[model samples]
Target: MGKAIELNQVDTIYEGEKIPSLKNITLHVDKGEFIAVIGPNGAGKTTLLETIMGLLESKRGEVKVLGKQLNGNGSNIRKLVGYVPQEYSIDDLTPFLVSDVVLMGRYGKIGLLKPITKNDKTVAKKMMEYLGISELSNRPIGKLSGGQAQKVMIARSLAKEPEIILMDEPFSNLDFEARREVSEKLTHLHKTKNMTFVIVIHDIASIPKVCNRVIVMDSGKIVADGKKEDILKPELLEMGYKGIAC
Candidate 1:
């Protein structure tokens, strides 16, 4: 596999904090690989994702994506990447439909002052269909359940046609069946689309089903990196995540 993303000795410090959120973090992701970043709370998982997305500045080291340097702004880099946040906040009473939110994914490519074209609408509709949410396209985003809303978010991300997709705790609020369905859908997409995926997940059990590689972080550092069956051993799980591997 060819390298899709690389971080070398990356470090970041939030305002007014003496300690850095990330310390000397280095990793490389291959193209079309499904990688899971797993860690306990305050382990800098969010910070790492933000750094890759160019939402936060790196105080030290370099981050390269798609063979190009990520200079913090990352506007050009972002064009090839899609992000689905952990939570979706919208007013229940708002009139915006699910399709409307999905269409927003095309805005970055469409540019300002240009109206959404037929091709953009077609793409958004196709993404919705791909996610099995075509029936909910006309529903209000705020009225959807947690799982439904998450599906919409995933659809929106896919509509961007990005080479790399980053998801932050997408199944955190979902029920058991919903979680399984979403995981399977994500796995299917990754395999069929040949896209690189970097997901931040808290559950150890889900990692084996969703990711090919597992990265364990603790105290703002990567403690272990290997295949799921290798790194998810009982001892490593207890030591790094302080939880059962289940």
Candidate 2:
């Protein structure tokens, strides 16, 4: 299997910060792998995703996506990556509808100045239908509830038909039933579309059943990476949480 993502000795430090947010991170993700990155707060999970997506520049070492370096080709590379951030704020009066927001995902492929094609609208509507949010198409994005907004974001990302999807706390706003529903949808997509996913999550129980790998991070470093069955064990997880080398 080809590598979908690679990070070699990567260190990312925020401006004016004394320490790196990510330290000496060396990792590889194979194409079509569903991975769950689990850790407590400040574990650098989000930093790793941003670095992989080329949103944050690394102070040292190399980051690659789809066998290409993320340095100079970030714009082109990002079009193939779909990212759902942990938090997105929307004003109540924001005029864009859910369908419009979802269609925005095609902007990279459609070109910023061009009109939206029929195919683009079809893809957007299909994504909404797949996500079970078709009824929300005409609703104002700003007026949706938190879970609804999150579903819209998921639909938007899916509309891009991206090769890789990176989600940070995607189910944070969802209730138990909704989270399960979304999880099943993601699993189905992973199986049918062969899309790679790296999800940052706080709750281990919420990790999707389709996730085959788990990465544990602490104090800005990856302490363990292995099969889901091995890494999700209580003893191993406790060790990771306690900062013991796994």
Candidate 3:
């Protein structure tokens, strides 16, 4: 019922970089909140999410997620948070099957050393159905197209049964129809399960209609945060970005 994530004046720097990738970022996300983070290239959108997940160690200030501090043994906290990265590399001929990839999502909850149980497989298959990819279960993952592969990744994340899901540029590879479908799917999950979502996206057109809050970032700083309608003002396009927000 409290904040799901909190960051206070946090600064994150990449090794060998003169300037921090994230600067003075402060944010609090409530439980069950759906947030859209949109910005032009070079914004710290990715860095901000990474910092909250302890992927980017904070150079200064504090970060707490689900009541756990960012520093020290964050594995337990990570198990509660699902992250779908921007890109993952796999050989075009990789032998891994779609089911295999999705099944790995359960490894966190099932534990690294334990064998997967029947319940785990059931959950993974349900996730596949939710993503409309159940037919691909036996197919080789590398055989799928860009949009199909993205759905597989999302299903994989959901198999973990995470309380909060963080997605980065999830709609980048999808066609317009695919993007809208996936957006609606996310909205359904949020509505039914009260799931918390913070998605980093470039295309404003793809922002799920269910998202009530939006955060805008530029030059490693959060330039604006408020109701989705208020933050997407026309003038926002003039700041940092060159083309349409979508």
Per-residue lDDT for 128-161 in model 1, tens only?
9877899999999989987888888888888888
lDDT of 1 at 94: 76
lDDT of 2 by residue, 16-83 (tens): 99999999999999999999999889999999999998889999999989998985647766888998
Tell me the TM-score of each prediction against the true structure: 0.89, 0.93, 0.92
Candidate 1 — worst ten consecutive residues by lDDT sum? 237-246
**Ranking of all candidate structures by their lDDT, best first:** 2, 3, 1
Off by over 4 Å in 1: 208-210, 235-246
Model 2 accuracy (lDDT, Cα): 0.90
Model 3 C-alpha lDDT per residue in residues 1-246, reported as the tens digit of each score: 988999999999998998998989899999999999988988988888888777778889998888888657566667888888887876789999999999999997777889999999999999999999999999999889888999999999899998899999998888877787788888888989899999998877677878889999999999999998688766556553332222
TM-score of 1: 0.89
Against the reference, the lDDT scores of all candidates come to 0.83, 0.90, 0.87
Clashing pairs in 3: none
Better of 1 and 2 by TM-score: 2
